[model samples]
Target: MSPLADRYGRRFPYLRLSVIPACNFRCTYCLPQGYHANPNAAQALTLDEIARLLRGFTVMGMHKLRITGGEPSVRHDLTYILRTAAAVPGVTKLAMTTNGSLLTRRLHEWMDAGLNAINVSVDSLDRAKFARITGHDRLDDILHGVDLALDAQMPSVKLNAVLLRDVNDNELPAWLEYLRERRVGVRFIELMQTGDNLPFFRDHHVRATALETQLLEGGWQALARVADAGPAREYRHPDYAGRIGIIAPYSKDFCSGCNRLRVTATGDLRLCLFGDFGIPLRQFLQADDQIEDLVHAIGRQIDRKEQGHFLHEGRTGITPHLASTGG
Candidate 1:
């Protein structure tokens, strides 16, 4: 494998690719009310073009590729994209992030197509409350889709529940119970700066420390760290085969092992999720730019990644929504 380290000594071997700019649901913490249905209607990359970009990334020593979206499953050709990514020479893992509404029928095919794992966005359990959070009434569909994932024997299926204060914070125990019964991993993601809906911080935020205390009280033991986990501090229950993860990007910082980079659906290279800067890789690809040139440019961009995202401490912020950058 090629040396993956950048000028700042940060290695870059993992890449998150957003195959589609469009999504099916309108989660309040994500997209805005009048957000365009097609953020890239004028410039969505074709599946073949997306494959070419992945090829470039692999040539630069990228080994792990995650497919994210505006909801990745909503894309009709998502399986094709996954297959293409898995088929890349140096790429070893192809995972996806989705809302889990559309996984009922196609999950088996996805597994067969070399999709190694999945991260489903499920915030609330109460049907009406979920609708309030996501502006969609597909909780039942999501539940069914999760079942389908376990049934399909996905290697690393994880449920991603973004905890919100007063809304779902009190329901963490209940959510853990539900997953415990099913024997699936659950990850609680602290909500960060993303869409226009995040207007204030005082009432909406819940720190990960509070959630960890609640989990311990609820009988979930903290299993020691898995080897070299990038940002998440993982724990496992005593008896259950499943585990739980806490991503505390807000209260705690994991900028040191931050080796990830994002490729927007329209093909911009986002260096850091919270930093307001990116170089347009799609523009170069569309201009028939050479692969080696693209790799060198991406290396230059990662060398410029911000030291950290200090939003609460009052710093300049990234302009694009978290969805656009593969949060």
Candidate 2:
């Protein structure tokens, strides 16, 4: 099968699949107050349907799969989903992004199911501040889960921190010190204005360049670029073994090298994070007799993918909530 390439000639080998959109946390940036589940929650793809979709994507040269959600760990069939996705013929890497609140209890189970990479979203290390940010007091649980992932010796265990000015930005140095001692890779992501986070984003969005400047002033050295499939620009400090990365989606716009696609929990293939357009794959999967048609549909979506997102231009379309799209 041919590689899935967009009109810009960028090939997509990574697929981000959102299994469930119901989250336990109401992070101010991701799931602000009053956020509700999609009215079509009942239409979420079943385990078998998800598996078939994975197989279809794999056949089209998607080798890396990242299971995501409002909280993938909250899904009852998470283990089954992991096993099924990892078992797909062409899938070379199986990963997950979670809140890490429930990971301590199931870290080993997830590893047993062939999980290779893990990214935990931990915005603040301060207990009280964390509670305020996530609307939950589960920082202890999330920290324990991170420890377990490190002990399990997974190929990759990354801490994803979204930088919010005046919110958690003050914790940057502390977070670096904490991660440095633990030797875990940490990526600082700039707040994006997609979805309903526009109001919050305007108030909290911090440019990665500013953060990088701060790090440099604090004696952190810019290291050689690491070969990563994602968009983060990596850096390292001579005294710390852990690496640091900055994802400036809005400020830097790394869309030229984008190599990923996203699937909503309801089986819609999203070509761009900031774009509202998508092609529904649920009906085709339900029929189960149109493999070729599924591939063609996917190709059409790829062809329609925009050259890049328009957040820099102050044009954020009516995108689904971050939870629904598994950001």
Candidate 3:
């Protein structure tokens, strides 16, 4: 029962499980026209399958489990999934990333079901700009949802903004002001170059280094990171109550500290976010006693994991957009 590690000596203690691949938001950088169900794609994992997968991951030394989706709120049984993951003996952290559109109505349900941490996608603070990017006029409601999350004392209330060049890039000043009074952490992620977003990526992708420069100039100090933490490099400011994180995927040696693995909604174990292929796990996920085979298959497949992804070479393998793997 050794830990889940690649040949490069990196151990994975985190897993991002995509519960569903269908989202309602038409974020320009991701699903521009919203999600259309693919007739040929396998149906999303059932609740029991999810429980088995969680158990397998826990046995392999995964301490944190993130329930991701095209947007998790789109799933009717998300709360039940959360409860099942919470019931897993080795799962110390239970989190989910959402679009925040349904946070107002579902936040409490998620918490009662054992969700302690949450990340909501809030690409822009400006209502109109948010609408322009997401094709949804729900910024007001989303922001309100954030406030409710904080007031209810959710252990974590971080926000994710896919920084765009000419779009919401210069809104750092507004973001700092918002973070000044709240205890939330706002992460400005550099928009990645996906197969479908090459043109759009060219037009709007912002380098996270540029944002990091702004943060340093504003007296923000980089904080030390733990082994199991996500890829984001966090910074703190003495003058603000909240923190800021920069997820610079393009940064040099960004993949050196890779600690998380992903599973597609259909039960494919994806070694890397932009990996060339996936190992089908659904066959073993069909029965309760199949957990051993599931773990063994995972072990064999992960041995072939590359040292790092070839994203810098302009190769994004099978990922057409962030929504495909719950990025």
Candidate 4:
């Protein structure tokens, strides 16, 4: 199979697959008002369907797969899905992004099933602040989960935090101090203007570049860029064991090197995060005879991938909820 390349000649090797859209936490930045799962959960792709889609993607040169969701762990058949995905012929790596509330119980099982790495979202380390931010008091559990992932000796365990101004932004120094001795890498992501979070984003969005400046001033050295660093610019401090990364989606347009495609839990193949364009793959997958057609359709969508998202230009397209898109 030929490598999947967009119009701009960027080859895609990563696929972000959202297995579920219902989360257990209502993080203020993501789901401030909370969410209710669709009553007809049957509308979602079955475990077998997910496996088939993953196999197709791997065949198309997608070597890196990241399982995501409103919270992927909430799915009852996640283990089965992970095991199936891990067995795909061409898949080189399997990772997951979770809220970490449930990792303490399932991290070991997931690791055993071939999960290569994990990125846990933790906005605040302060117990009370965590509860207020996520509408749940699971900070201790999340921290324990991170420790467990490190203890399990996973190749890479990262903590992903969305930087919110006047919220957890002030905790950067403290968070850095906490990670100084830990082995896990931490990434600070700038809040994106997607879905209903736009209003909240407008008020709390902090430019990751600003934070990076602060880190530089504080004595962190900019590291050489990894060829496949994705959207984050990584840095390191001589005194700290862990590395730091900053994702400036809104402030810095890192689209030229974008190498990923997203598949929503319901099987929509999104060409870009800030754009509404997508191919409804769920309908095609429902028909057994549509496998060939699905493959062709996926190729078409990849070819149509936009030059870049225009959120930085203040132009909003059909931005879906971050939960639905599994950011």
Candidate 5:
């Protein structure tokens, strides 16, 4: 059967899989300020389950996969999982989203295991501020990992910077300078009020438009038509090797070209980031369902997808954190 297409006619060719709900850092904005670093109430998917689920999705015309998590690098079997996921038929692109601190020793193995690209989360360039924002003093480790990723020849290594007011927002130019020198893609994300940090969100959030203005005034050139290119709107300074992108989930919602769905580490399929409900694939796994059945199950979930999220509607509903909802 052909894979399901939403009412907007976008095909479901992408799946963002969260390998685990656990994370090493307790980024203040990620959860409540001073929130514990424990995993969410959800249980993550096992390796066998993820492989079997991907096999089914592959059969159903899924083409791209992103291995994400609280920090996918924190998962012990990440290299093995990446290898297995890449080996699956029809998976043309295999990628990961990491915090970059743990990429020291395993990066080479991950590249050998066929990770096509990577996106690393880097909030601040200043070591002290980095430690304050991420609740970790591993800035040196993260910087080292970035070099390793470039060395491993990972195609399109993006450095994701989550912009916060009065925090790392002042360091955007410095970030661009550092990353451009290394020829990496630097993406800035607008802080969202969703998830466990709803209260804290009010204090730290900044509009992406404001951020773009800051970057341009600082001599950065805006790349044309990036807002139309899905979620992240990219820009660059002329002659700079690195490009800058902004993910404005709060300020500028990108629901029209959203051809992505999320499969939680635990196997619950989520249609939209703000949509709280998901279909449980674990039942099918336990019942020994056929590959097609699992595929159809995912398709059914997509069919029920809402037009977009209600974030702009005063953030009425509380969405899950970045960890629970894989990027």
Candidate 6:
């Protein structure tokens, strides 16, 4: 397999593909005002186009593919999308990031279609607080579906929470209790500044260092990150059945180990989540024979990936929100 590495020696093995730019739920940190469809926006890539796109990625040795979105499960053809991704040669892991609202009824169907791993967004464990944070009161049902996924022996089951100061930041003890007997992995993502959320970012952003110190004092040991893992610093405790991960983007040298790339739903290659530009791949996706051009185009851009994001400099490139590029 050809390694898709940049001049900085970072190899890309994981690819996040946004199947759709629309989501059903309104998470305070991500989609606070709800998703507004752009009528002039290019329609999402077709199934055939997705298949061709995955082939180009697989040739570059990308083995793990995570289907993201505003919410991937909201797509009517998500099963086909998963199947197309899984069918690609060298693409061994087919996973998805979802709100998990449909997991209760569609988990088996998704799994049957070659979905082996899943990451669900669960911001707050408290039902009422969760409703306030996500604008949805399905916390109980979401957790129930997670339990069912574990019972079904799914290979990987994880939960993601965007840490907010004075909001859900104090719920670590409750999370620990929930993780006591479960093997699921929970990752707390630090709030990131995006193009349109400055006011909200200022009010709710919190550092993940405090949580790391708390975990260290509480006996959690750092876990070894696998080669194709996402950008999370994981930790494990001997007594607890589950593990914890922190995605502190503002932490020191955060992008030093970036092993992933993202593609927008409309077939644009995003080198950095916050990069101001996107190299259009739609032209190459028009035909199956265009794979060569697509691969070379991607390879050329790898050399252009910046050392890291400019969030520290108060620069959020073209991304207006997390849902825009499946953050």
Name the best candidate (by lDDT): 6
TM-score of candidate 3 versus the correct structure, residues matched by position: 0.98
User: In model 5, which range of ten residues has the least summed lDDT?
Assistant: 31-40
lDDT (10s digit) by residue, model 2, range 156-203:
888888888998888877877786777688899988887666778889
Ranking by lDDT: 6, 3, 2, 4, 5, 1
> Clash pairs of candidate 5?
45-265
Query: Candidate 1's residue-wise lDDT over 1-327, tens digit each?
Result: 365565667777788888776677777667746246654354666777787788788877778888998788777888888887788788887888888877887888888889987888888888988898888899999889888888767777888888788787777657766866676777888877653445634557778888787667867776665322346677777756677888888754567667778888888888777777667887556433577777777766666777677767654356456676678
Each candidate: how many clashes? 0, 0, 0, 0, 1, 0
lDDT of 1: 0.75
* RMSD to the hidden true structure, all candidates: 2.5, 1.9, 0.9, 1.9, 2.8, 0.8
- Judge candidate 5 against the unseen true structure and give its global Cα lDDT, from 0 to 1: 0.77
Error of 5 at 218 (Å): 6.1
Q: Give the runs in model 5 whose Cα sits over 4 Å from its true position.
A: 32-43, 214-230, 286-289, 316-318
Which has the better TM-score: candidate 1, or candidate 3? 3
Clashing pairs in 4: none
**Most accurate candidate by TM-score:** 6
Stretches of model 6 off by over 4 angstroms after superposition: none
Backbone clashes in candidate 4 total: 0
Candidate 6 residues 121-181, lDDT tens each? 9998999989999998999999999999999999999999999999999999999999999
lDDT string for model 3 (141-160, tens) is 99999999999999989999
Q: Which of candidates 4 and 6 is the stronger one according to TM-score?
A: 6
- How accurate locally is residue 306 in candidate 4, as Cα lDDT from 0 to 100? 79
lDDT of each: 0.75, 0.83, 0.92, 0.83, 0.77, 0.94
Clash tally for model 5 = 1
Of 1 and 4, which scores higher on TM-score? Answer: 4
The TM-score values for the models, in the order shown, are 0.90, 0.94, 0.98, 0.94, 0.90, 0.99
Which residue pairs clash in candidate 1?
none
Model 3 residue runs over 4 Å out of place are: none
